[model samples]
Target chain A: MALTLDQRSASRRESRRPAGPRPVRGGQSPLARRQRRIFGPFLAIPLALYLVLFIGPTLYSIYAAFTNWDGINTPTWRGTDNFTALFDDPLFIESFWNTLLILVVVGIGIFVLAFSFMLLLRDMKGKGFVRGVIFLPHIVSPIVLAIFWGFLLRHDGLLNALIVKFGGEPVAWIGPDSAFLMIMIAMVWISTGFYVAILMAGVDRIPGYFYEDASLAGASAWQKLRHITLPLSWDVIGVAAVLWTISSVKVFEFIYAFGASQGQMPPAYEWNAAVFVYGVTFGGATPQYRFGYACASALVMLLLVTGMVALLRRAMRRDAVQF
Target chain B: MTRTGRLRRSISFAALGLSALLAVSACGSPSGPGDSAASGEFTYWSMWQEKEPQAQVIKAAIDSFTKDTGIKVDVQWHGREVMKKLTPSLRTKAAADLVDQSMNQLGNGLSNTGQSADLTSVYNLEVPGEGKKVSDVIPSKYVDYLKDKEGKPFMVPYEVTGEGLWFNAKQLPTEQPQTWDDLVKLLDAAKAKGVSPLALDADNTGVAKYWPLLTLIRAVGPEGMQKLASDRTGAAWDDPNVLDAVTRVEKLVKGGYFAPGYNSGQYPAQQNLWAQNKAAYILQGSWVTSETKTYAAQGFEYSSVQLPPINGGTDAVGVNFFGFGIPKTAANGEAAGKFIAYFLNKSRLEGISTKADNITPRADIPAPAALESLSKSFQEKAVYPSGAALGLKFGGWESTAFQPVAQSLVQGKTSAADFVSQVKAKSIEFWKTQG
Candidate 1:
């Protein structure tokens, strides 16, 4: 019966194809000619725009990285000086370290929390409502979240006020030693929800019969999750990991808005690679306008992220588990 | 034809129409050098927002200039980020004929880049209906202080801002301290009375640097501060005077003189605390008076004193000027110059003091009540433009090297000696990258 149904659907798909002039061997079909005529103009505009707006600047930035361009001034070739100087820059080094810390540390915190929530919600009543609640923070603007986070953690802010009210001494939650940690925590909190949703969608696709069968065979919840759920959701998890790898590197505005004071960038200790680029080029009371140097740092970040994503893809690759 | 096919064709046509509309509209705006000039309209990009008091005063002056000279002016209130926006426009014909910003910003963005026009002619241009030339009414010292790298005047002064120890007269009416020791004594007395001696928004590196920079400027002279900032080897930080300044900062930190959590909270937090009488003093710019006005304690009377002299150091006050400059490529440079001269007229310039609560370069105009003491200091003391300007010349030295070290010292995270060492190390590291 399934074979007959497959053949019927295949015949229907075959019927949907345009009945047009047959292709002259080694030549052309009328449909191909017509498709080219219709879509060629459509494709050309965006392709041209993409080249001009995106690819052109990308290529220019790669070139700019080797020069001493100050945006307005004509660029002069400095060879590898900008790239070499980056290693000597304490700010760039600290920012590079901070960016890596966020990617690995905050990245782990997000995935672990997301997976746990995905499991917890699978059996919970009103799981949709609970999921929606968990996802709320993802929708709010990061700037607004940063402000709210500041008010909660700042000295004499709400949390401190509450502590003082309870006869406890106020603590500097966002002090120099702890500000970056607080930022990382806020990042994890903000990010876990989106990952949970991605993960939940992946978990939802598993057939219920596998869990039922495992249960009848006296399989435990952990066993079912480990054996069935994780394997089924592996591809989605891989995609989510890649998504996070890219997004984490791009985390700028939250830290920028949170740590900033009087329109100046946050202190150097709190900066990530993204903020480092902005600080050197166009940020602060007087912009440094080191376009070439900024581009070099940016290129470094780009290469590192690309290499990391590639490694991640290799690590996550596995044979698909078809049920 | 299939409905879907027909729909797809219509969608493509709509997209094509949209792109055509966008392309046409993009070309419709008047941009390019000489366009406004040929139309006989002067274009100005102001550094003040339209709603700001400074802009209101300038807007009135622009209106009067147009009325008196019959020259139409097109103004865009680009606010504080005007320099960032104006830089790209400099290479294009779209650049404003006139722009205004702090001297340091102009130095970094335009004058240093040779984008500013020499405004010596404008300075000599006579004020409309006033016999005095623009240079005669405004002090030459200001002109000299804000001159371009080539020692040519590029910007005309309108508003003057200076940094000092701000206090509320209603709360602490003590006489101004003359020496660093006396200042410390005053802070101790204020602390003994259960008031936080100082308010520091240490998170704001710009404001946080004030304590160290002021101390350094007072210990060594402005030139000394400039030398340390511009030092490529970073060995200048090892100077005894730099140590003295850092030591004073350490003393303040160890004494617990700063408001609680000063290093943790963002700006305006500690400043607001100072306004509420949670702290007795705050080292800030002249603008602090107006900025904290709304949040001030009832019966608050804003007052300030010049940073006290340290170890018989020169009594030079640090002043920053906000002013106007005509770009080199300006088409309507003559008209812009006339407007600048007209704006300097005492009757028009007084609005900067009266309405804006700021000190104008015109010494004849009485300063606003809050800034009276700062204005007096500027007149009586030997003035040096803020070290911030010199710091910028060294390429990110202020933000990247000095600010972080200063922050560490003020935050009590490092000792004075450690601070100096760290600064020396960071400065050397910073200058290495400048190559």
Candidate 2:
């Protein structure tokens, strides 16, 4: 048989190719092939875990938000009633604002303080030791810290006892008027160390030569921080802000431990969204178990976190400064 | 691919398959209550912490039960956290065959939600070798408190509790205050002696409002408290009797009778203050002794009294209680029932009273001396359910409406009329959503 031009080319290409096994592009080498073999289920296991653990509960919660289920009874559909009721609820409104305040006010306080500490520690002696001490609260259980804080501020507690011993009248440091403020301050104390560590790591990655050059140029410390440090560490700050936003919304244990002496829940004035959700459900002297309503509150919190994170990403976005 | 590569891939695939199989197997079947007849073992969850005297007594009873019945029970002590865990656990296959917890441990107790077995049959069961039915031993009044909406007793009554004004025998008179005015004078006399006349668990939203609500319920009658909750018109709270109760409570708080920091003091802190005689009295439940036992001053003695009648209205008393229930999911329901019957038998309950420092629900068991003084008031002509007892309406009200307003009232941030108006408005809003 006479060979055509296409047949002649195919023969040429085939003869040029190495024999034994066919070559495949895009993750088809022997090692890649081995990886591929395990990859499906290696990926599958975690993906399945994520689906089952996180996504499944999230979806169920969303469905429950529209119903009228006490934790014990069969749920009944209540449509948007739970949402409508929540909007009208003063407690929910207070909790929402409280959450927002923690996110915005507390968030700002933490970032500024963290940045300053990071800058100070960047050039300071024995920075590692200082960091370990400051980060101690972060590593220690928040419940323990809160208990210590309470012991310090309680009526006959250490602080008040000291004041009285000094011939000063006892002050209600953790009274109703000042308790929320104390909580905010305690939160800042607890979380600032974590953020400082994150910010410091980001700042540390920048070459020390940049600061030397700035000093050579007579650029003030503030100017250097404003122009060089912040812009360079922008990505870490963005991530930190989003993390704080998410975590502050879920702030329960620290505040809840404050109420351990109070019974199932703290006073309403001290409650934030997380405590509110718990209070409406099982965390009360009498169990309300308003599961559907609590789900609605939780969904609102989820939306708040999602929205804040998205906004933070947008607001903090900048061109990557290649070092 | 190379032979080794192919072999590695096969091994990886096999490993992944094995892990997945192991994971699925690890999930296992949800554990049901054990077959007591076949395996001779059952499970129980107790709400009391093990160190508590009540837990010790129960443990002794369980030991007795095992020795007599030859059925082993596994008991888990979860304490106050039991309520948070009970509902979800009941839905699972790993549910315990029996649970010992507060009567109001679940939402309105096991009877309201039908979560536990209808223990009415347990009431008919004879206590082992005691020759008495459970009903014959436990008081009918206490049983009445345990009834569900269907008039069935879901809890086997254990500890009976009451809420009243408690005073230190060393500091204050144990005699009843003759009238509301006389009570004010007595409070003043205590103040003159450098002790605050009252202490409050005001930092607790649920507990802070108990004094005001219970007094109002008694002053206006149960019907009045019901109207305050149910009446959408908001006029129910405006009843003169309600106002009188609210005003007098306001006077007590505003009169500087309470400890200086009472409005802001946390639960059990104010209680401890009373224990140390910093305050002359505390409006507390029967468990106050156990709660403050550690804080007790040397030679400290406790006695309780009913609140004096307001405006010569009928004298009423407030009582709260705790007991135990068995979940409906229990596999060994018969064995669990027998255990409950044995636990509540008269002799066993008396031991509970003496050893646990509680008011056992069995009438045959006399109250300890600390509570004996208040027994007459508890048995008074008009029996009033404290807000705690009205679990259905009181829970949401205390959390949402009453406590916050009461906080303001005690702080002098809001007036009695404002308290009434706020409660009415909140009640209307609360009931509207409840439907």
lDDT string for model 1 (B1-435, tens) is 544676789899989999997885554343323233444578899988999999999999888787877889999999888988988766544368889988777777777766777888888888877899988988887777767767878789899999989998987864878878888888998989999999999888778778888888888888888888878888788778779877888988998898888978877899999999999999998889998999999999988987788878878788899898888767677778878988988999999999999999988999999998889989987888886465457657777777877888888888999988888888887777777
Candidate that scores best on TM-score: 1
Question: Per-residue CA lDDT of candidate 2, range A4-36, in tens?
Answer: 665676688777777666767432577888888
Error in Å for residue A143 of model 2: 1.0
- Which lDDT tens digits does candidate 2 get at residues B1-435? 555676789899899999998885554333222223444767878888999888999999999999988989988998877756767755433266677666666425455556666777888888877898989887676677677777777777687677778887876777888688878888889888888888886776656776777677657666567667667667787778787888898888767777977755556678888898888888877678777888989888878877776665656666556776776656666677778888876667777778887777666678877777666666654565556365565676656767778766776677887888888898778767666
TM-score of chain B of each: 0.89, 0.86
Candidate-wise lDDT, in order: 0.85, 0.77
